[model samples]
Target: MAALWPLWGLSPGGSFWQRFAFWADALDPLLLLAPADEIRRSRLLLQNSGKTLSEPIQDDQMRKAFLLSLSSVHPDTDKIIPVLFRPPAFLPICLPLVIVSSLHLQAKATFFSQFVFHSYTTGFALINGNSTTKAEEYSVQEKQIFYSLGAISYAACIGAFPLVFMNRYTMKSPLMELIVRKLLPAPLLGLMSAFTVAVVRSPEFEHGIEVVDRNGKVVGVSQKAGEKAVRETALSRGVLFGTTFFLPNVLTYFVQRAKLAKTPRNLAVVRMLFTTLVLGGMLPASLSMFPQRGEIKRADLETEILSSTEEPVLFYNRGI
Candidate 1:
């Protein structure tokens, strides 16, 4: 699986479309249902083929195994990431949560919906981070719980805040209410999504993650690389949720103006369908925005790491 990373958009300098194509295939939900024995066999096939060349031989079986491994396993630790948290499960799980959260529901329902969405995303961010070598002191389950709860609370509050405010202080203008209730949530969700990633992965910023040379040798831990990884992931997440939440509403507004869906039920169905399409497209595009194995100039790293390696560039996993 590690050997196949570069071919799967972990390498540097692929066009966004190229990366998107890769993710579209790799994130297939069917791969999530593959049994343990199937995954193990796929890994074995790739490992055996990877020994002979830099790239695995292109074949149907090889492609299936590669996608299965990429979806199910973590690149940094070689451990199976939890089923719900894996990239393959991301769309199926998050799409509905996102749709439900974006709905014009009652305040309490909105809060609950946002809470569940953030909670799941928090777990996804935590499990997908490139923190395989996180400092031993930070390994306690309590710290993880604390971070998770803090992120979920923060996001849930932010997500439902607009609706809560409008409900308390009735707006005189329909335009103002529309702006407050509809337009505001997308950017807020986007911002809070990014925030959740930062809060959830705070330990990585504190303890640092392992950086590797061109040959994939771990030189040493660097706080700089960890910050870069988390920052990139956060930015990608912001683009994802922000666009996912914002675009559908804009389209819905235009649709309403044109009387595209006259009935409330029809409008609701159209909106949900739009949200689904936007999320499906944006998830891959956002994730493909940066190379999973990100590069940083050697000069920008710590003095000790610079002295230890002659390579001018270092790479680290920028988790999805």
Candidate 2:
């Protein structure tokens, strides 16, 4: 049997198969299955059957041996619930889930298709009616609408043009085709979503976001603070999407490897359901890491709004 993992990290073995095994093992946390017992069982079975799975188990032939042994281990333990019947369909949407559960503007995708493509941004002025001179609050919602329109209006321009260029009467690898047709769309949307949020919210930099004093009274606005806040929001959105970027592809790979689905559509449905649940569980923890109302040192403020005797605390709403 393979030895226990080291205290530090996954140990790199001397060969490629060993490396692949290590990564495959790494994927279990994301898979939500504790694989230690199953893996050990597979190793023991192979050994008992007179198959040598050495410290360096580098043979391609051993791949089938390992899978055969591993196949005996059940992935699901609960007999009471079937997969589809475990959850409802369509009551909650991914976009809003991506928004509220997001760690901020970062994880929320502006999607256009099952491939999750297309987006645009708009600028809106949010002016406080109470203030004598209104500071136009940047219209993030307007920006999203414009992004949606742009995605719909020029769908061919963005998605098709590149695809056409990639396939332009020339032959390409199957991997490249997968990248162009399937793997590429979601990350592209993610990048566009990040870019859109940053640019549309730039108005915050000009008008400055409202910074409150220690007592929560609105003092003079700070453009620098707004820039910092917006930058973090944009970055968090990128981080949110980062872990999920390859999720669908990875799920497809594992499902295929296990032959889990009865058909293509079945595989797709299972992948989607898993993605939704995994993301739902992840969102709350990610968002909870940072406070919605962020704090800053009063001394960091560009505007000297705080009095000499005032406390060294200030606050701003870090938007989702």
Candidate 3:
């Protein structure tokens, strides 16, 4: 009974019929009837014994089977639910959290477009350039200035101009529009995103971000190594924007020409929904692909940082 207490939230009512209905609704488009089987087994165990389903299963095999049947359990997590899915995480509930008022949509979009680069640069400088590393440091004002320049340029050239000019693309071929509106802007924005990071953090390359030992003590800094770190971070940013931004737009360009989007209104709604889903899924996965804490070899460092330590291994932040 104590063990199954957490699953009550998946159920909607007090009795068997209610529970069945709850499971039915919750698991709509149900995969393999897994939820139903798990619930049935729990109800069977809870029967006339007057014990709640929360009681720990006395049978080891049965308990293992019951746990493995859970919908929320991940295969790699020893069958336990991930912390991100737990009640306190507030995610599955929060996906629906959005601004429904269309009047503010353009404003919100512009704000985020500008904020994203600034936020990325700030974090990049701070995390990669630890508190004690003056060589890697940029003042908050300097970072803001660089971000504003880069982001405004990026937003104007890659973001706004295309939207304003390309709304009614005159290109006869759908493929041409895909190349012009989707493929071109995506990679360009990606390059500009990386450019923003590099410009905002150019000083770090001249100096260096902190390097650390196994003891968490600062070893020394190397400008060459800093260049590599910034380059990799910027490249990753560029690739993310290119893949996530361009790929879906290209797909939608072709997809909109299909019979499904025969009407202009239908095509517009479909494009908006599809683009939202693509960005939501792609951005996180792409950004996470880069190694956060990059490794370097003793041979790669400048002689000063090299002579300062005998340690063969060094680590630095590859900022996201």
Candidate 4:
């Protein structure tokens, strides 16, 4: 009675009718008949002083049978009423918007990928010199620069979403036309911004000083040591930044480009190639930097000293 009252929202007159209507509508689907059976059982119980139609059977067994019958029937109009007859309250309320908005993501990804392949990668190769001696040196340095710029570029591109929205709202035009017109430059901007940042930071590589011991002797050569440090930094930062911010935008670009191509074979090839180069490459590089990998998690000198001191504890006498 208490539970039923709450279900009725603490009122009897209006609540009773609402509750009755809800149940009737829920049962109206006829998909299941358990509700009708339960209603009949309730009526019989009221008329017969707590005795059910199956009164010859034990209460526990009869209750179990009733529950079994309820569970066995499929929900339908014939068996029961529909709850909230207009539409399912929860059948992906966002689905229509998603279908409508999918073009944006696709356009963004397409623009981003083109910018990366054509501009970012190519620009660096030219600036750093593509010859063998320069190539070997610059490959390592270029990766480090890429690590920093990738995240910033990706974020800036996504930040343009407000403009995309503005275009949609202001123009009394088809969404596809608005998208194509507004989003065409997304990839070029994303790639160029990332590339420019990488170039600016490249000079920072030469400025690091060498670490010295108490004796004033250089422990390691400055440039070599700096290279190692930078590599470690890049390993930790680069691929993650690229994958999270860069890859999705780039994928959107590639997908849109494929759509524009209008050739199924070309689209499939482009998608596979993009996935292989962007996502596939980024994953392994990111995983390689995990702190859990091998000796990367090893304790520093202070920790090692502390660990060494603990070895004597088990042998020490408490009495002393």
Considering every candidate listed, which one attains the maximal TM-score? Answer: 1
Say which prediction, candidate 3 or candidate 4, comes out ahead on lDDT: 3
TM-score list, all predictions: 0.92, 0.53, 0.54, 0.22
Deviation from native of the Cα of residue 129 in model 1, angstroms: 0.7
What are the per-residue Cα lDDT tens digits for candidate 2 across 222-273?
Answer: 7766776666665655554544545655776788889988798787676666
> TM-score of predicted model 4?
0.22
Q: On lDDT, who's better, 2 or 3? A: 3
lDDT of 4 at 30: 41
Worst 10 residues of 4 by lDDT: 311-320
162-236, model 3: which lDDT tens digit per residue? 444545554437776555544565666666667766766666676576776644456776677678777877776
Ranking 2 against 4 by TM-score, winner: 2
lDDT, each prediction? 0.81, 0.43, 0.49, 0.33
Ranking by lDDT: 1, 3, 2, 4
Better of 1 and 3 by lDDT: 1
Off by over 4 Å in 3: 1-132, 135-147, 158-179
Worst 10 residues of 1 by lDDT: 4-13
Name the 10 consecutive residues with the lowest summed lDDT in model 3.
95-104
Point out where model 4 deviates above 4 Å: 1-103, 106-160, 163-238, 241-265, 290-320
lDDT of 4 by residue, 106-212 (tens): 43654454334333332322232211122245664566557545544554355344455555576436675555434433343334434543343343235332222
Model 2 segments more than 4 A misplaced:
1-91, 95-161, 169-172, 306-309
